[model samples]
Target chain A: MVGTDTSELNAARAALVEALVRTGDEDRDAFRTVYRLTSAKLFGICLRICADRQGAEDVLHDVYLTIWNRAGAYQPGRASPISWLATIARNRAIDWRRRQARTRAVGVEDAEAVPDGAPAQDDALLAVEAHARLHHCLEGIESRQRAAIRSAFFGGLTYAELAVQAAVPLGTMKSWVRRGLLALRGCLDGDA
Target chain B: MATPDPDPDMTAAELALGVLDGDERAAALRRLVAEPGFAAEVEWWRDRLAALFADWPAVAAPAHLAARIEATLDRGAAGGAGGAANDNDHRWRTLAILASIAACVLLAVTTLLMLRPAPLPVRVPVTVTTPPPLIAAIAPTTKGAPIAAAYDRASGVVRIAGGVDVPAGRSAEVWAIRGTAAPRSLGLLPARGTARLAVPAALRGAMAAETVLAISIEPAGGSPTGLPTGPVVAAGKLSG
Candidate 1:
């Protein structure tokens, strides 16, 4: 079962990369193939950060359009295809939140109320080895630092927002996140 | 005294975490395009941090989303000739001819309007105020080949039909050159079938009449030195 799952994950990753390359060639069918394979994951990222279905849908539309134009710039060796796609989704969602912030305030209580623990379905489509490695590394960090990192990533909140929500000084929050990230990087690099 | 450079690793980590504000984020994006070393650093952070979201639950998007995306693509294609058809060489050739004639007509009308008396009420019947899209037919260095290529000015894209094969262990890179200027890289070309390459914004103004477009075979990831360090296989000029 373990072998099958690893192979399947690798196959899915390869298929996604191939589809993106084909889309670069302006193959409409390949574009459709890419959307079918990855839209769910991207939409989930958008929805998580945007916190609204309509906003997520709009951001998802822009994400695929960007993929259409920028697929040629994708280098397979630099990063996994899903990571690249997720990066774009997250950036768009964050930008949406930033734009909305000018007119409406994001409720600090509501954003902080989200549970920081690992979700049950966390490794469903991610590489199992990488997931295990990250979980292990995260355990080495303080709980507050870990929660701050998770909340910032999943909620697309800025350092200031994170600080306000945690009821900590802004500098304290920044140091916690920066130190946490550095430690996490050291651990991940050591494993490699 | 000059300001000290910010820490690259810290900046990359902040960017990867999505904690940078608007202006900071914009500056990071500019660096990602113009400074490749910085780009690689950013990519490293992204790859490392991506594992944090490995367990994000996958929620299926609305069923209509795919249809909506397809419709948007079709609407965009209808606006320009570049994305209209992939396999039809004849259609592209026809577009090139029409575009050429339109260019000539536009030039003639503009010249006539300039020379005519200011008070003349003679209104030209042409509604086209913009120059027709420049195009080119890329020809291989060797004899007749099935691959057809054209650049559409309106869409700022180079459309390649059919296939161009590179030898094993090599890749195809596209470059655009104007007059005596040095060739600018336009990214890599696909090995086969149709591909639409948007003209990079930095090089958009150079896509004019007399400019040359060429494809060279390079190492897999592309030319490492930013210059074409490979043999040119096919070349052409924007004709109209």
Candidate 2:
């Protein structure tokens, strides 16, 4: 399985970090290489949060522009390059979603009805151990909490919005997420 | 396990999860810039949780998108340089017009001196020199009208006029960007009213008519990092 190939993933991660560093030095070609290596995943992120191909495309453009401008700010020691890039993509997508929501009301009911299913079994970009550990830790949490956390992460829903969708009190939703995150952190740290 | 501090950690986790509403999110963002401990906590959450995205199926962007991005970058680079040049051209034309006016004044003075009697104190020849100070209107990107900035070339001081009400816990940071150069911080703008910021000696030479000045909303005492870490509220090119 691709996840089991630690050395290859580590090597790829190293190369991406190098490319990101080069991009920080304002190497346009390195930026292009970074784009080529990561754009698909970032585009997927944009598409999911934006829920529109055209808006995702525009958000993707802004994400790259921001990456180009903020590459120097990337701290490789603190986080993996893919995680850092994904964070930027996710934030930009969320911002786009928020702006769109302001212009036209989004159907909270429609979004809430979407099922929180198990993540499909496929090749993932994260390290095998890390991925396995996360899933294992997730398993320890309540199913509702896990589902809420997953929905929050993937759907970019605020606590109020998630509460409204789940037909639960806002404070209850917040408590579930807070407890879930604390538990997840404890488990992850314990393993280390 | 040590008992976790609920409130701050929960806030950080909420921020990292992108679940905070507008006001709460803004407050968290401010803390991210102002408090190192808070920022680190937020980063810790983000780093761990980022793995959740690994399952997202990668969708290939359209083939044309790469080309489009390259073209956009090219245009951005070219546009930046071209905008600076255009501002410079406009400055020179203004200077020429000013010089012509000075020339006419000089001619009038000379003619008056020539026509006056010798008893009139002999005046030195008037020389038309020194370009007018460069001025730029720094327009806010988010809202409100533009702020006027007047740059004195001789003094190397930029006087900014027009009030911008920075939120209680934030300060406005000034940044200067020349053609193709990264944005350099010009220090923090005052919380309210007009202020003068001196151009650094190293950057003074680069502060031409084409230079672009921007103000970004930052944490109190300005951005902890030298580079701006917040939204650029206002920006404009310098012109004489």
Candidate 3:
């Protein structure tokens, strides 16, 4: 198990709980802390769903606004704060994907591309650290299964679509995901 | 009959994977939540997939987006006239917010009503008239439900009716995916209300040739990419 400081975790949880309780107004500073802590990761999630930089950022803005408004709804025991945040991120990204389809009328030109750039090495390091610390459970799956799941989850392909993309039978692709999920569930359960 | 337990095919795992789109996904979600094991299954999937996001590329939003959010929040805090505009802006946010909530609520409702059949609310027959033979055929399909869509070949208009169940902060977009070419965006759809979406002219030929019609979740306006940047919620084959 990754060794996280118990005290630090407790403090973060306490603070989040306190923020939830003190609730007449939506707290900007508290939301800021949540934003600073989660934005990059949330952005990463949005990027996967939206498939570009600008789209992800747009989704990120909505996600934060949602988090700020929904802070009071957070339930600690049902899920960890990060899990809740991830849920929000995933939901926003999915919503963005659907809305884009509806807005463009089935073949209009998409918006401008999200800009591309190389980041400083420190940013890479931080992203790597964040990824590893948060996603350790993913490391347990077999490589091929991991690829299939990622293609479906991150790449957003249907099983038939994955079949075409991965050049495998639809059944095989489905099996890969099912087995992969079974393993992942076990791994995550172990972590918990 | 007691709603059968959600088969393995319709599990949240499948939903999160985008295996089910449009009515299939919606129907599955509606029925599956009635199953006792579905919630546990959804929670399991959420934890498993949360890590996949780590590999996603970064999306740096325009400063204006942040400014927009701040402005909305500030306006909301101000109340009165500013608050009214915030409320209007909030209508946009409501779709995404409500969509996620709707998904959850659907899950909950499925669980609650799984054993009981949903009441069929009586709906009045709606009549639609339009200029072209194609438009006349498509209009009636959109009248009753929150979402109705029809395509007219002569006018190259695909009329969409109804609103997607969007979450409080998110929005929905319509997507037209072509067979060979890349998928293109149509425009934003209403969150909870109904709207008519005009399919682009270029897509008319493709629609005649059997194009894929898909709806995805997007930011308020729509996605920048003509291709889908969000999960495909509902999808169908379009015929002119």
Candidate 4:
């Protein structure tokens, strides 16, 4: 979260807000322009999570139509329009995540046009802190519980798979994962 | 020991986070949906997941994609152009098809009558070979309308052996009986000699079918009113 300002974020935010505000009977062209502008980037976010280009493109198409229809529902000041739009993209991706089979592990090589970049010191530190917080929060949990949560969140492994990996019973792995997530949520709430 | 109370809807957040799997995940989502509070928690998880993807960089869209969308919009805007063209072609084709069918029906009726199973010899009226001169003998009763000559139905033919004299610039015209409407033009009669006219097969039924076959004489150009203007020189039954 270091050096993340409200102002720079607000620039992307303002464009979307203005677009929604100006979206009326006469502004169909504006809506189309916005769709053309944002669809590719939004598609990228969906593809990363879905790991299927076709599925990502479908979600992207749906998201734009939804945005066009619901533009009047946009409330500025609560969140930037771009942020709102991004939220829409991400939710669609997450909805797709559960449907995708874990057997298909998407290689990074298969992803199109992923940028290679050196992580800035501040960005890397923030990422490290987030990971550390997650680890520290799991420190008090039993090994089985921690393993269950990690398998679910990062590995995309099902409880049955996690149980097999941990050499534990499936039911126990499920209970551990569920309870572990609840406990972690409580701990994260405290940190906030 | 107290009974362990099972929390049915507690896993909704997990389901929303994609933490549940198979039947368990399905049951969790269903239960969560059943309980309002759990559903709200799931919604929260959804929003949280949504927020994370906001960090990704926006990519520029490909030009061809916009073109494709525009093309789709254009095709829709043309209002069923492809279907309209198909229907127009289909309409003309249908009309032509119907006309051919009508002509076929007419041909079939004539063929059926000719091939009647009994093969009874039809009696036809024969023309009198020494019939009186058309103008002097038959003109008054004809009321100046062209004479309708009767023919033999058995013979199935008509041969006009003589012509009536009309004043110069006036031509004798022939007609086939076609009921109450104006008569159909057969052709021009000779000024002072015999003229032959081929009787049409459909006209075989003219007299018996209660159809009156009459002819009218008119100016050289034919009847403008489509009715006779000249005297009926000769008249007879078409049947022989």
The per-residue C-alpha lDDT of model 2 at residue A108 equals: 61
True interface contacts reproduced, per candidate: 0.41, 0.38, 0.23, 0.17
User: What is candidate 1's CA lDDT for residue B109?
Assistant: 21
As a TM-score, model 4 comes out at 0.44
What's the residue-level lDDT of A123 in candidate 1? Answer: 41
Per residue, candidate 3 scores C-alpha lDDT tens digits across B105-140 of 222222222334566995645653443323212211
In terms of docking quality, model 1 is acceptable
How many Å off is the CA of A185 in candidate 3? 3.7
lDDT of all predictions = 0.66, 0.68, 0.51, 0.47
Backbone clashes, each candidate: 3, 0, 58, 22
Q: lDDT per residue, candidate 4, B1-240, as tens digits?
A: 332654333465565455555456545533432344554455444433333333344555445656644444444334321222222243334333333323222122233333447656966567644433222112223345443344445543444555565555555666553332224344456665555544443434432433333334444433321224344444333432
Poorly placed runs, candidate 1 (over 4 Å): A1-4, A72-79, A108-110, A113-125, B1-9, B22-37, B79-240
Q: Which residue pairs in model 2 clash with each other?
A: none
- When candidate 2 is compared with the true two-chain complex, its DockQ is 0.21
* Worst 10 contiguous positions by lDDT, candidate 1 chain B: B101-110
Ordered from best to worst TM-score, the candidate numbers read: 1, 2, 3, 4
Candidates 1 onward: DockQ, in order: 0.27, 0.21, 0.16, 0.07
Docking class of 4: incorrect
TM-score of each: 0.62, 0.61, 0.50, 0.44
TM-score evaluated only on chain B, model 3: 0.39
